[model samples]
Target: YCMSPGIVLTNACDSVRLYGKLSLRRCNMDDDDVQWPFEHEVLLSLTHPAGEAEIHLQVDPWRDFGWYRKPSESNNMSVCYSLRSVDLDELTRDGYVFEDQLRIKCKVVP
Candidate 1:
């Protein structure tokens, strides 16, 4: 599993875009046994309030152009999504954002 501490929201062509980074790390216990260049499909979804539908995004580490391989202790990749991917205003109006906080669900797919 990976975590994105911050997501950058910017205005682009009359719409909004979200940019963030995802990374993989070498765990102390599993580094030796686990394979290098961690390649797993990760699904991230923004949860909606009152059991509404979620906004989903998929990340494939294998397509990151060698950035997925661990050089030192961790490897990183950049990710971005625009209106073509998701609607920000619609999500906000639907209660996806609450108290200035957004809920994101992550799932690792092998």
Candidate 2:
């Protein structure tokens, strides 16, 4: 698993477009072992108050996993993922001024 941190911003009344880059580290598992390749998935969970809109940028895991595969498994081993909408239109009535900040937690799992 890998941990990445980044900053995102959204317009006060408009749907915010979240865009950023995340670099995942390669696992140190040995090369010649039967488990020569390790596969994992990345899940993004975003939370905001009621009446807020959520948006996401599409990313290709197969291409992103290029740096994580073993030398011999480089072409054959890759990561795959699916985007599941946990919830949408969650009601949030809070208001904030410009420069106001909020926190959301993100995690990557195997």
RMSD of 2: 8.4
Question: Each prediction's Cα lDDT score?
Answer: 0.57, 0.38
Writing each residue's lDDT as its tens digit, candidate 2 over 1-110 gives 23353433334354543433344344455445434223444444344434364333333356445555444421332233333222112212233212354344444454
What CA RMSD would you report for each candidate? 3.5, 8.4
7 Cα displacement, candidate 2 (Å): 4.9
Name the runs in model 2 displaced over 4 angstroms.
7-16, 25-38, 49-60, 63-65, 69-99
- Checking candidate 2 for backbone clashes, the offending pairs are 49-92, 50-91, 50-92, 51-92
- Looking at candidate 2, what is the lDDT of residue 45? 38
TM per model?
A: 0.69, 0.35
Which candidate has the top score in TM-score?
Answer: 1
